[model samples]
Target: MQSYVNVRHSAQGHPSGVSVLCVSSELCNRLGACHITMCGTGMQRCTLNVTLEQAMILSRNHGLMPRCIMQTMDIMRKQGPRVELSAKNLKVMDQMTPAFPRLFKLCLPPSDGDL
Candidate 1:
């Protein structure tokens, strides 16, 4: 858990990198924020600060979530908002599972290094 939070936004900078879509923190919701950095070169380093409500929107609409936040959201949905989730307590949910199919597939760098 701390490992993910301590993650830097970038290791090697990339021209086209990870993008953190903006969420409404002021007007819409302001519960919490998640800062995540993807691990790769030629990629963007970003920290997304968003409310819990906004996180749900991203997962529902765009299927995007910072790793830890996603698990937190799952706990919130299942256990209700009053409960808090610890990394040790919250079991990470699989997005691709039959009950929760992913709408988008991750596009990774080529294995052969053709790019």
Candidate 2:
């Protein structure tokens, strides 16, 4: 999932330009990893184990921008269930907000197919 946050101006009304946040995953030989890329003011890239929660937290602390982080989390919260259920025998055990880091739980689907 990817989200972009455009900052047109700073508090002083100076042009600050735009920034982009991209989140993607790779699976190779049953080893999966997640990567985050930030581009605009500067560029940064990092790879980590496939724990999106941790990745988001790290990104938030890394100064990628809050709007970008929230947008990415919203996309994941909306699409996560479908992605989880597409597997042959997988189930969603719990739904938690990655942005707030366990502060809230999302309502679960009534059935796997219902999502």
Give the residue spans of candidate 1 off by over 4 A.
Answer: 1-22, 26-51, 54-66, 81-115
TM-score of 2: 0.22
Residue 92 shift from truth in candidate 2, angstroms = 13
lDDT of 2 by residue, 22-99 (tens): 223322212555333333321111111222444455564566564565565456555654345333223345544225
lDDT of 1 by residue, 18-113 (tens): 122233332233555543333433111211222344455665457665565556544555575323322213444323233312322234444665
User: Cα-based RMSD of the predictions, in order?
Assistant: 12.4, 16.6
- List ranges where model 2 is wrong by over 4 Å: 1-52, 78-82, 86-115
Query: What TM-score, over all chains together, does every model reach?
Result: 0.20, 0.22
Name the lDDT of candidate 2: 0.39
Candidate number with greatest TM-score: 2
